[model samples]
Target: MTFAKIELTASDNAEFSNIGDETLDGLFGSNRTMPAQGITEFYGASGSGKTQIVLHLALFFLTHSNNPRVVYVSTESFFPIKRFRELLQQKLTRDYENGSEKSADKSKTVEEYGNRLLLTHEPSVESLMNCLTVRIPKLVSECDGIKCVIVDSIAAVFRCVRKSEIPYDERSRILFKMAAALKRLSVEKGMSVIVTNQVSDIFPNDVFHVNQRLVADKKPALGLSWSHCVTTRILVSKCDPMSIPVTLPGGKQSQLALRRLHVISSPFCPNSSTFFVVDSNGISSVHENPTL
Candidate 1:
C-alpha cells in the first residue's frame, strides 16, 4: 500500500531531458511552465508510434543528458531491440560527427549506453505492479541518475483483465494503487514516469461518448479510473500517408507515413500538437519551427 521513502538528492529536481524537436522542447524543456515531473501517458491505436516516441525519449536522455539512465519497461510481446540499437547508433554517430567524442572506441560506447538503459519485460498486470512498486524503487536506490522510467503501453496489462477473473472494484483499486506508486516514484523520487496506452474506437452515441463527454472517436483504454492516474495525457495517432520527392541516385520518391502527437490534457499546455515521421533515424519532427 506504501512505497519506502527514499532520500531525494539535490539533482533529483534538476531538469533531465530536452527533446531536440522544437515542438516537444517547448513543452518539456526548461521553458515549460509546469514542473518537470509526474506521469505522462501516450495513448493511441496500434501502429501509432507511441512506443517509438518513448523509445526516442529514452535514447535522448541516454545521449543528451548529463549521464542519466532510463528504465524502459515494456509489456509488448516483441520489444524492438534491433530498432533501438540502430537509433542509439545513429544518435552516437551524429554526436561523433559533431565532434562530441574524441575516442574512436565506438563499440565500447555502444555497450556502455546499452547498459545504462534498463529494459525489463512485464507481461501481466501483476508483474507490472510488482515492477513498479518493488523493482523500480530498488533500481532507483541502487542506480544514481535514473532520470526517467518508461512503460511502453501500460494499457497492455489492464487490457488483459477480464471481469470474470478480476472484479470491477478490485481492478479499480489495483489501477489506483499502481497509479499512486507511479506518482510517488515521480514526485518523491524526482524522476519522470512515462507510460503508453492503447485506444478503443468509440461509436456515435456510445455511453462514454455521451455520458463521459469524450470528444474523440477513439478513446484511450483503461477508462476513467486509470485516466485520472496520469498527470498528462497525449494522443499519438497516424495521419494520411503522403509522398515526398527525394533526390536519390536515380531520383526516387518516398512515401512518408506521418504521425501526430497531441497533448490531449496537460497542466502546462493542452490541445497542442506536432507532426513527425519515424524512420531509420528514429522519430523526427516534420515541420521546422512548428508552432504549438
Candidate 2:
C-alpha cells in the first residue's frame, strides 16, 4: 500500500539541545537522539531527579527561545514550590546578567520572559488530560507563542488505577488513552513531551538467577504497556548497592546520590544501556558501564 508522506517542518533550524558534557552521555539525550515531538518516558526509582531534568529542559526552551512556551503538568501531586522558586530565582539572575551587561534599557522584556514559562499542577490523569486537550490548546490559540510542554511524572496517573472503581481492562485502556493522547497533542502542537515513570526492582528469583536472561521474562504488564505507548523508554536504576554521599552547596547538607545508570529494555538499543550519574556538578555519564 502506497502512503502519502507529510513534509516535516525543517526543525525550524532549532538548535539541537547540548546533550552531554564529560561523563554522562545519554544524560539528556546525549548519546541518543531526541524526537522533535513525541513521547519520552524516564523510568527510575525515587529521588533520581527525573522531574528536575524535565524542568531544566523546559526552562532551557523558554529562556533560549522566547517563542517556545513550555507547559509542565504534574501527575504525581509532586509539584514542589521550593523547586519552582529555585528555578525562578536562577532564571531571574540570568536576566540581570543579560548579554553585554552594557545595555541601560533594562526594559520589560526580561520580566515578561519569566512570566512566559507557564507551570500548571493537575492532581489527576483525568484533569491532566482535560487541561492538555481543552485548556492548553485554547491557551496556545489565544496566547502569544507556546512551544514545549513537560509532564513531570506520568506514572502517577496509574496510582488512581488501584483506586479506580473500573474494571481491569478498562484501566489498561485508560492508561493507553492518556499515552496516545499526549503523543498526538505533542505532534499537533509541535511541542516536545517528556514523562517520568516509577519502576519496581525486577530481577529473576534466586532459583532462576543462574541464567539472567530467563528472569527478564517476568517483566510486569504495566511496564510492557509503557514500552508500547512511549516513543522512547529508558529504565534507570542504581548500578552499585553501596550508597555514595554527595555534598551540597550549603557545605553540610548532602545527598546519598544514587550511582545509577540507564538500562535499555527496548529492542532498539544496541550499545547496551548507558551508565549515568547526577552529582555535585549535575547529571553525567559514568566512564565505565556497570556489569549485570
Candidate 3:
C-alpha cells in the first residue's frame, strides 16, 4: 500500500518552521496525529486545552497569511481572544529576544499578524456550516490562501441537534451536511481540518476518571458515528503531573504538571501516542516541558 508522508523542508538559514510548537519535528517523541485531508478530531474533556492548541495553530497559519489561510469555527463560544493576543505578544517577544530578523520591523509585523487573523463566530453547526459554505470560500479566494480549518468544539455544534434514537431525518441531515461540507472543503480545496471533541464516559475503569471526563462509564457524547467519519480520532485527557513519578536522591518525587495527551488510533500515526500541555504560554510539547 502506498502512504502519503508529510514533507517539510528546512530553510537555508536554519530557521525553525512549524505549526506553532516544535513537536511537529519528533512527533513530540511519539506518533503525532494529523490528517492530510478530511477531519481530524482531537477529543478530550473540558480544560484539556484543545482550543488552545488549535488556536495556536490557527495563529501560526494566520500570521503567515502570505502562505496559507486558516479558518477557525468555534461552537462552544470558548474562544480566548485576549489570550490569543497575549500569546501573539509573547511569541513576538520571544522572536525579539532570540534576535529574530523580523524584530526590526516589529510594528509592521504585529500589524500584519493582527490583520491575518480571520476568525469568525458560529454558535451552532447549522450556523457554522452556513458560514463555511458561503463565507469561507470567498475569504480564501480573496486572500489567495486556504490551507487549514480548525473547528473547536466540533461536538458542540450538535448540542441542540442531539443524538436521538428516533432517527430524526432533519437532525441527521444537518449533521451529515456539516460533515459533508467539511469533507468537501478538505478534499476539494486541499485543506486540513482539525476539530475538537468531547468524550463520553464508557470507560471500563474509573481509575483515571478523576478529571470528570469519564462520568460513570458513559460513552463519548458524540457517539461512534462521529469518530468513524474523521480521518483521525485522537483521545486526550489530563494527567496529574504530580502522579508522574521522578526518582530523586531523596525518593520518588511527583511532579504536578497537568498535561494534554493524545493517544493515537489506527491510520492516525503509530502504536504509541504523544503528550503536550496547553497553558497560558501556548501549547508546548510535553517532552520539552521544563518540569519534565
Candidate 4:
C-alpha cells in the first residue's frame, strides 16, 4: 500500500476578519494580522458588556466579510434579538442621516444582514457538546463562507452541573475533551472560536497585613484546564463612570459615562485598556487614542 502525504502552507488558511473596532484591532498587532484559527476567551463580571462585545463581533463578521456567516451558541437562553435589531437599525439610520447610503438600499442591507447570523440555544453541557462537535461542523460544511463560532458564557453550563455530582476529575476530563475539540475545529476550519467565561472571586493575602481579609479578586472561571486551551484571553471590567460633558443634538449640554475595556492577557499584544461607549449603534471608542 502507498502512503499519502499531506501538504501544509499559509495559503490554505482563511484570513482573520477585523472585529470592526479600530482600538480592538490595533490591540491585536501593529499590522493587525491576528489569525482567526484559535480559541479566544472573554471573561468578566455581569453587566460588564461581555455579551455586547460578542454581538459586535458577530455584526462585524456578518456585515464586513464576503458573504460571511456566524454561529452564536448561547447557553443562557437569552439571545437578545430585539436589542440586536435596534443596534442595526440605529446604524442604518446614522448612515442615512449622514448621507452615506440611501433609505431603499439600507432596508435591503438590513434584511440580508439578519439572514447571515444563525443563533442556537444550548442550555446544558451535553447539548453544547453536540453543538460544538456535531451540529456546528455540519452547518459549516453545508453553509458557504461561515467564518466564526461564538459561545456566550462557556462557564454557565458547567456552573449548572454541580461539582459534587460530577466530581473534579470527571469535570476536568469533560472540559479537556471539549477544549480539545474546539481547538481542533478552529485549526482545521480556519475559523475563529470565541468563548465567553464567568469570573470567580479569589482572595490573596497582602504583604502589609498579618491577617488576610476576604477581598474579592475576580478571575476567570473553569480553572487551569480550560485556561490552557485558549489562544487569547481578554478581561473586561467596568470602572467608575467617567462623566464627560457633551453637546446634544438639540444643542443641550449632557454628560455621558463611557465604559472602559481592559485587556488582561493576549499573546500577540501587551496588557492594555481602552474606553468606549455603548449606544443605540453599539460600542464606539470614546477617545481618538486608546489608553495603553
Candidate 5:
C-alpha cells in the first residue's frame, strides 16, 4: 500500500472537524472532539464503552453522508459485527420513525450503509503499521470519499511487543512514526482519525499511600510518549452504578446502568464529564454535568 500526495486547501485544514452530533461533540469540551488535522484518543479499561463509541461514530459517518466512508482497523481478536449491525438497523429504524418518510425500505438502506464501512484486521504491530502508513493511504487515494479512520484500542498491538523481545524504545519510536503517519493522513486526506487505547494500573510507590491502602490509579497505556501524539484525550470509565427507575409496560419498575465519560485533556474545552448509557439503540441518554 502506498500514499498519494494530495494538496489541501486552507478551508480543508480547518481547526476542527465536526462529527455533526451536538451531544457527542459537546462530550469533549466546547468544540469538536478532535482537531481537523490531528488525532483523538479514547482510552479506558475493559467494558468502558470504548469500542461502542468508536463503532457509533463509524456508523454515523457511514449513514449520515451520501458518499463518505469510514475505515475501521481492528487489532483485537475480532470486530463486533453483531453489535455494529444491530446499531445500524436501530439507527435506520429510528430515522424512519422520526422523519416524514412514509415508506421504510430498511434492507436497501442497511446494504448501502453497511457497504460504506471498511473493516480491516491488524493483529500485530508490524501489520498495524503497514495498514496505517501504507494500506490506509492507498485506500484513501482510491476511495475519494473516505472521511474517517478508526483504530479500536491501539494498545492491543503494542501489548504484544511488551511480552516479546522487542526493546522498549522501539515501541516509542514506532509510536511516533504511527502518530506522524496518522497526522499526515488527517491533514492531507482531510479525514478524522480516532484511536482507542487501553488502561493500566499505576500503583503509588510511597509507603504512606500503601499504608493508607489506596486503590491504584488507572492511566492510559503507552505512557507519556504515546499520550503526546493525540490532540484530545478522553477517558471512559465505569463509575458508580447509576440506577434509573423506569416503568415497564405493565407498570413494573426497573433500573438501568450508566457509564461516565470524562474529557481528560483537550485544546478546546476544560476537563468536564458526562454520564451516558449504551443500550440496544446504541449510545443514548447523555446527561452533561454543568458543574465539572
Candidate 6:
C-alpha cells in the first residue's frame, strides 16, 4: 500500500478554560489551560497537590461553560470525594454570598455541578485503555459540552506490568498505541487532555558527572516514549511551608501553609513558578513581598 504525506496546521483560534486558580492558570500562557486538542502532563512527588489541581480545573470548567462536562479517570484509587465536596460547597457559598442569588438557587446549581462531573476508576492498563478508547467516546457522544478529560496518576496503572510476562518491545508498542489513541481523541473531539504522572529518581553517574551537583533529581515517569505524547508538562513541588495569616468565616484569623507550583516545560510559555494555598475556597495564589 502507498500513502501520501500528511500536513496539518496548528489551531490559531483555539480557546482555553481556566483551571480555577489564577497562579496555576498563569503557568500556562494567558492564565488558562493549554489550547483544546492538546495533551498536558502534570508530574510531581507525593503530597504535591497534583490531584488537587485537576479537581480545581474540573470545578472551574464546569462552572465557566454552559452545560459543561468532564471525564476524570483515577488510577490510584485515591479520589478524595470529601475534599471535592468541600471545595464545591465553598465555591457555591462564595458565589451565593457575593451575588444577589438566593440560597435555594445555589443548592440547585451545586446539584447540577455534581451531576456534570463523571468519575471512572481504572485499576489496570487494560481497563484504562478500554475506558479511553471505548467508554469515553460513548460518554462524549451522549453528553454535550464535554471540555476536558483527565487521568490521575497514569504511572500507577502500569507500574506492576512484569517485563517477563510482557516483553519490553510489546509493552512499548502498547504504550505507543495508547498515546496515539489519546492524541486522536483530543484532536477529533476538540477537548483538552490532562494526565498526571509520578516522578522517578534520576541519579547521575559518578564517572560521567563527578563535578555536577543536583537538588531536584527527579524526573517524570514513562520515559521518552510517553514524553512525546504530551504537548505541555508542569512539575509541582512543595517548597518550605510558610504560615500565612488567613481570615476565617466568622472573622477569625488563622495560619495556613501554602505549596509552590513550577512550570517545567511548555511550547508556548517560558519556565516560571508560583505559590498557592489550598483552602476551603479551593486553590488561591500567595503573593509574598520581596525581602529587603
Scanning candidate 5 in windows of ten residues, the lowest lDDT window is 207-216
Candidate 4 Cα errors over 4 Å, as ranges: 1-14, 32-34, 92-107, 142-145, 205-216, 241-257, 288-292
Q: Residue 287 deviation, candidate 3, in Å?
A: 3.3
- Tens digits of per-residue lDDT, candidate 4, 96-116, equal 686642222444567677776
Q: Write the per-residue lDDT of candidate 3 for residues 118-185, one digit (tens) a residue.
A: 56778866578787676776665555446677888777766666446325556556556677877776
Error in Å for residue 70 of model 4: 0.7
Q: Against the true structure, what is each candidate's TM-score? A: 0.82, 0.69, 0.71, 0.80, 0.81, 0.82
Lowest lDDT 10-residue stretch of candidate 6? 1-10
**Whole-model lDDT, model 5:** 0.70
Evaluate all candidate structures by whole-model CA lDDT and list the values in order.
Answer: 0.70, 0.55, 0.57, 0.68, 0.70, 0.69
TM-score of 5: 0.81
Candidate 1 lDDT by residue in tens digits, 75-115: 97667889888988887887678676431245457777777
Clashes of 2: 4
Assess the local accuracy of residue 163 in candidate 4 as a C-alpha lDDT between 0 and 100.
71
Tens-digit lDDT track of model 6 for 1-292:
1111111245654546566555567777764556665678878888888898888777766665555677789998757888888888887776677684322245365767777777889998889878887777666666543577889978887788786876767767767877776777677666777889998766665332222113245777777677677787777766554565644344555576656676666786667777766666677676552121
lDDT (Cα) of model 2: 0.55
Q: How far is candidate 2 from the true structure (C-alpha RMSD, Å)?
A: 7.3
